[model samples]
Target: MEYSKHNIFSKVKDSDEYFLLNPLSMQADILNSVEAQRYKDKRIENQQEYFKKGYLVDPKAEEKLFKSKYLDFIDERDSDEIQLFFTPWYTCNFDCSYCFQDEYTNPDEKVSDAVMDAFFAYIDTQFADRKKYITIFGGEPFLNTPDRRASIQKIIDGANQRNLDIAAVTNGYQLEEFIDILKGARVREIQVTLDGTHEVHDKRRMLKGGKGSFDKITKGIDLLLKEKIPVNLRMVVDKDNIDNLLNLARFAIEKGWTKSPFFKTALGRNYELHHCQTNNKRLFSRIEMYQEIYDLVKTNPEILEFHKPAFSISKFIFENGELPSPLFDSCSGTKTEWAFDYTGKIYSCTATVGNVGDELGTFYPKVDLKQDLIEEWEERDVLSIPECASCNVKLACGGGCAAVAKSRTGKIQSADCRPIKELLELGIGLYSKHEI
Candidate 1:
């Protein structure tokens, strides 16, 4: 018997105990100093208990287990659910300071009937055997214009004909105008972004003419809540808006949005994607963002009522009382999720959707595929990347974002691993006392 290659051992801060984590088995144990020293010296007292928790295993048996897990991870690529992301137009009404797609020119081109016809035809032929859903993406999908409204209705009508449910990510500027149409369709959930309270949110997410949008967006949100539509409020966090996070959370709670069954919230790091937005320097790293959030939660426990920050390791342990199943890959990319834009171009993920060089193929007007590009994205799992294959924290990091990897290294086959060891250490210190 030998120590498992996947075991991560770390000392618990300010305590004599240590944490033994086996990501493969999703098991964690707190050991006293004596017990930890014994395990380190290969003189464990309870061999049966160690082996049972996957801390120790026969070398031959370990090889078999690794092969099985890796194969199972790969097999998950054959998903039954086909998630299709459709972008109606590239024009957005808001001109946010840190918009990732700010570089994209707003062509304001309409979604022609031929484009819709081709989209449905592609879906019918390619995804007929799979369970399918439509995700309306944009340039603010809910633009309050007759042309945009008609385009949205066309999408809704097409999905309704096939009994497929729809979800949308919109700026929420014109959601009220499209309420009747949305109510008639099979709606799943809609995601809207609110940077902070009125003053902060207005400055960050405002109209192209530089006017504040807080009042309109709030009214739209109220309308959606009244209609009983599920809403996921998202906040893009950076140094500028970090101070106002608690304020926003408190406001949401006071307004009863947090208590609503149809409401949920998430925080996204405002980092650079394809091109850096104006305030790129103000963005926070993963570690920095989590630290700030941890501090916030410590100060005002009531904020937890509005949104529970999913701080990776701590969140997994809090929810399941064990480590999460080791991730073989972080993103779905081209395997499960595909993005189709207004011009019929297909992208591997939403982050790379409108970028010129990242096109996987064209699905409409003709079915032309760049097989080589598609294969690259499909094989971007942790095990496939050379740097990730031998890393101790590969399972935890899941090889990071493929688009970010490509942008940084000029290759999708590389990894953009996060500071997993540091995160694990932080999680151990914060959650050890709360462990079941």
Candidate 2:
């Protein structure tokens, strides 16, 4: 048993390969390859500059701050409840193979009003008199076609009437079509996905007609820009798209997407669905992909200023110091969030909805879905988990994305851990050297 000096984990690595917590194991030679050294050095130097500019924080330090701040804010005895996610529809226009919601019945089917009422009622009670952040996500939220859109509008209106913060994650294909509704609805935040460049994005995401959706999606983004809606363009990286990620980043920078109100990149969610497995033939190990991207950004110093919030969070901790709260290395859903399916069934997050045994509980007469979930989340305190406690980077990585872990392993406790761990280390290394 290798105990980490950080006391974050009891045993850093286990006998099972999947349980191994070696950050180095996930690194790709391409990352440290001699040809990449020049870039890596440049990245370090640039990151230091970012630090001077107050652009980053040290991960460990951030963890300490996060925990303390959160603890001070949360009443230990009051049953701290902070976040929730609601997915109105599971039907999406683009079927990327890895969708975890596939297990749910097609979005075409309407969930009984009884379920919606029960679920919302639960939310109303648990968050009584208190404002909370709410996220709207879906297979393709825009697919509600006719009445669905109106229903979604109603949900938003209802939330707004209660004075809640709102956000949504969408595919963006229907963005242009929904501009009026979105503006009128006053959605606080909107996230749209772009997997890679046109070629890479189209390969993984396509329309029902088998046509690529890149063009249409970008057009929607342009529309958002025209509408001045706060937007975040989400890019998911898989093996097929890893090589081009920096290029994608550069593209985002060129379009001024970085400086724009919305822009972020997430590694591909772990798991292979039918179409999402397009990179199967050329799959790079998770560690390889993570390191390559980290290295790419490290060497190309100019891109650091445009780092997405997720990366910025990592850099913040690395450069400034850790916060007290546990970092959310895992899926955000597991710790502070969850996804509610159309039928009112609740899962840990959007990516793990359809997985077996992943349900925390369903909307039912006794469950009190809202209160139950908040209670369940507190019971499963992420910092106390065995796996997270034993890892040195535990504070930095935040126990890995819960959604990714559940999607790949069918259990919330066991998702692919290599990439996230490596990402934290890379971010820390970059931040430590930053001048600020």
Candidate 3:
């Protein structure tokens, strides 16, 4: 018998307790330092408890059974909802300092009715039997122009005709003008960004002439809520603006935005995806940012109303009383998500949507696919990654994002490994006290 390679240890916050987690085996236990060391060293005098929780296993038979179960998990997994992203055009009013689309986009490009017709035709036939939704994506979806609003109306109408719901990810500077157009439509939600309070946010997300956009965005949020449309408020945080998040939360509370049932929130970390930016130094790694959130939430519990970071597995276990099944691939890419553009191009996911040379196929004028490339993305998982095979956290991290892996090393099979062990450490420390 030997210690399971899947065992993970983390110390409880402000206590002499430790957490032992085995993600693949779906086992968790609390122990003292000596017990943790004994398990880590595989020096188990009492074999019953060790075997009961999958802490130790027979290297030949049980390990083989576990690997077989993992394969079964991969083959038997289910995805009921498919998300199709439509980037009508990559044009926006906000000249965000970190805008990834500005450098490569055509200033005057716009999708016509012909493109929309072909998109609907293709989507209708291809996904007719599947449950799916349309997501309006772009440089910014709601740009507040007569022509743009007309185009957006057509897109919404097309989806509505097919009984599909829609969601828009926009900057919100011009959302007020489009509220009536979206009224009574099948809108899942309209997502808007607020980096920080007005002063801090305007510095990073501003108009082309360097005008602040905070006032307009917040007013738009109010209008959206007034019209009973759901708004997903997102805050993109980095070293430069993380400190102002609490202030923004207080402002939201004062505005009564937090009291509305139509309002929702998410937090996004500003990290390098396609390429490193000038402000890349301000970025926090996945674990680093969560640690910051952990520290922040400890002092200011009110932040939970604004944004709640999923403290990885610990929080899930704390609430659900169990662990999730193994994740063989975290990148939904071609599996459950697909990105389409008016230019008739197709990409794997949101991260690689507008990127040049990432096109997997064309869906208009002619229908063709680079099946081999799409297959490469579809087959990506921990089993295909060389490093993940030996790593204990592979099931938890799911080998990271394929788009980022390809960008960093030009190989999808190469891993952009997440510090899952480190994240679980922080997670246990942050959420153990709230154990269910």
Candidate 4:
């Protein structure tokens, strides 16, 4: 027996303790200095408890077991529920500086009855037997216009007819206007982005005519909560607006939104999943973005109320008292998710949906697929990615986002490596008490 390559050790800052996590073994412990050294030393026979817990394994057989477990994971996930995204059109009323869709998704393409009819008809025939749900995605699905509202009505009606509950990803500027239409389907949750407090947010996410959207958006949030519908408040943060998260948190608390069980928060870092926008210098690398949140939490602990990032594995361990199943592939693209647009085009997932070149095929006007491209997306996983083969945290990060991976290396199976070790080290300290 020998120490497993999958074991991860994170040293506690300014202390003699270390956190040991093994994704493969599903085991963890806080190791003191001697224990940490003992783990590194060739004294496996001295640690019977570790042996039983899978920290120690036969070196030759470990790889075979991992591959077997990975197959089980894929089998289970491939049989899981599907999430279907419907993009009505790419037209938007507000102009946000860092919106990734701005370059590819233009306002000229609008949804018509013919397109909606084709989309719903296609999904009904293709996924009639699968356990699936609908997600209304956009340029702006809830825009305040007769035609746009009609599109929402049809989408909600069609999803309801199929007994599929719905979620929506929207800007929330016209949420109040779409409240009735939104209620047409069994609403799961609505994701609305509010980047910062009123003053800060207005400058970045402004209406086409230069009016600030904070007031209208807040009013809409209040309306949704009153209607007993759930709302997830998302903040697209970058260096420019990251500091304002604290202020926004205070505002949410002041508004009593934190009191409601229906309210939740998510932080979307402004980074390149595709090509970047101008002044992309403000973008924080993945770890740097999380590191900023950690610093903000130290400045005012209440920032955690707005967002509690799962920093690798600490939050899970703190809650479940056990390691979760290994993550063989983090990207859900062609596996359990798909996106359709009014243009009759099909995309692998939300991030790459509207971008012209990323389209896998079309759903409307015809039912066709580029099987070669589809196979590439479906084949992404730790085993398929070259960089992940010998990596320590392969099972943890699961090769990261396939869209981001492809953007960087132009290969769907490449690794968009995550700083799993660094994040786990910070996460343990951040979530645990007394710095012990």
Number of backbone collisions per candidate: 0, 61, 0, 0
Q: Which one is best on lDDT?
A: 4
Taken over the whole model, the C-alpha lDDT of each candidate is: 0.83, 0.57, 0.83, 0.86
TM-score of 2: 0.71
Tens digits of per-residue lDDT for model 1, 1-436: 8888888787765578887888776688988999999978989999999899888988788768877887887766575476889998888999998888878887878678888888888888878877888999987888878888888999999999999999999888888888999998888888889999999999999999999988888788888889999889999899999999889999998888987898999898988777776866798999998788767766776767777766556567766766776788887788778899889998987888889899999987799999998998988888789998678677777888999999999999998878776666666665554432
TM-score of each: 0.94, 0.71, 0.94, 0.96
Off by over 4 Å in 2: 1-4, 7-81, 97-107, 111-115, 262-286, 305-314, 318-335, 364-377, 382-384, 387-390, 401-425, 428-436
- lDDT per residue for candidate 3 within 338-358, as digits (tens), equals 999879888988898878999
Q: Give residue 181's error in model 1 in angstroms.
A: 1.4
The window of 10 residues in a row where model 1 has the poorest summed lDDT is: 427-436
Q: Model 4 lDDT vs. the true structure?
A: 0.86
- Candidate achieving higher lDDT, 2 or 4: 4
- The TM-score of candidate 4 is 0.96
RMSD of each: 2.0, 9.3, 2.0, 1.9
Per-residue error for 321 in candidate 3, Å, reads 2.3
